[model samples]
Structure formats: C-alpha cells, structure tokens
Target: MAKERALRRAAREAEAAKQRARRARIVARRQRRRALLTRLMPRRRRTGRLLVRRSRGQRAGIAVVTLVLLALVWFLVDDIALRLVLTLLGLLCLPALVVVALGRRTS
Candidate 1:
C-alpha cells in the first residue's frame, strides 16, 4: 500500500511538472513571435506636416453630404410639419459635423 501511494504521488508530480513546462513553452513561443513581428515591421518617418489622410477626408465629405441632406429635409418640410423631429435630427448630426471640421482644421 505504501509503495502504491508513493507511485501515485510521483505520477501526480510528473503531471504537474509537464503542465508547467508546457505553459512555459507557450509563453516563450508567444514572446518570440512578438519579438519577430516587432523586428520585421517598418517604422514611418514624416517629413514636414501632419496630414488629414484619406479617412479624415472621407469623414468630412460624408459630413458635408449629410448636412446637405438635412438642409434639403428642412427645406422640404418647411411648414413646421415635423419641425421638432427635423430639429432633433439636425442636432444629432451637429456633433459629427463639428468633429469633421475640427479634424480638418487640425490636420
């Protein structure tokens, strides 16, 4: 009975060690991949000014189109018909316009 218990204990210890080693190997592999990616990636070097880039331009264009659409809605609904709804819609779109304007001004 003593020998059986000792053998079971040894097997449990061996299993625990294997788990720890496997975890360590996974962690090491992740670290190595991260290192490789960092080494391979290229860094950008800007010369003169920070630009708006394409995404910002597209956002600004969308804002302009939306503003035009809102204006058209207001024009078509000019008899105070759904005035409150139109006002709320304009208010909701205001932040997007401001964001695009500010982004354009900055970049």
Candidate 2:
C-alpha cells in the first residue's frame, strides 16, 4: 500500500511538471511570434498636433450630425411625451459626457 501511494504521488508530480513545461513552451512561442511580428512590421509615428486636429474635426462632424438629426426628429414627432422622453435621455447622457470630458482632461 505504501509503495502504491508513493508511485501515484510520483506520477502526479510528473504530470504537473509536464504541464508546467508545456505552459512555458507556449508562452515562449507567443513571445517569439510577437517579436518576429514587431521586427517585420514598421510602426508609424503620429504627431500630437495632427491627432488633436483630427479629433477636433471628428467632434465638429458629430455635433453637426446630432443637430441635424435632432432637427429632423423635432419636425417629425408630434407627441410631447416622446419629446419629453428624448429630453430625459439627453439629460442622462450629459453626466456621461461630463465624465468622459473630465477623464480626457486628466489623461
């Protein structure tokens, strides 16, 4: 019984070691692939000014689209209840917008 228990414990240890080695090999292979990819692909350097300008343009486009959509909705909708719901939705979005603006400022 003692020998049987010892043999079983050894087998379990061996299996665990094998699993650890397999995991190590997988991690090493992934690291090698990542390095190879980085070597093969060139990274582009973007200027801060360009990024800021592009973001501003995007913000302006979004504002214009939102205004146009809101105008259309206002003209098409006759129910005051729907308009009130829309207004409530807009108000709910305001806090989220404020949080995003604050988060961006910190970054």
TM-score of each: 0.45, 0.46
Over 4 Å off, model 2: 49-107
Error of 2 at 28 (Å): 0.4
- Measured with C-alpha atoms, the lDDT of residue 45 in candidate 2 is 62
Instruction: Score each candidate by Cα lDDT.
Output: 0.77, 0.73
Instruction: Please identify model 1 stretches exceeding 4 Å from their true place.
Output: 43-51, 54-69, 76-107
Best model number under lDDT: 1
- On TM-score, the leading prediction is 2
Give a tens-digit lDDT track for model 1, residues 26-103: 999999999999899996656554543536676577667777877887788866768668878777877676566655
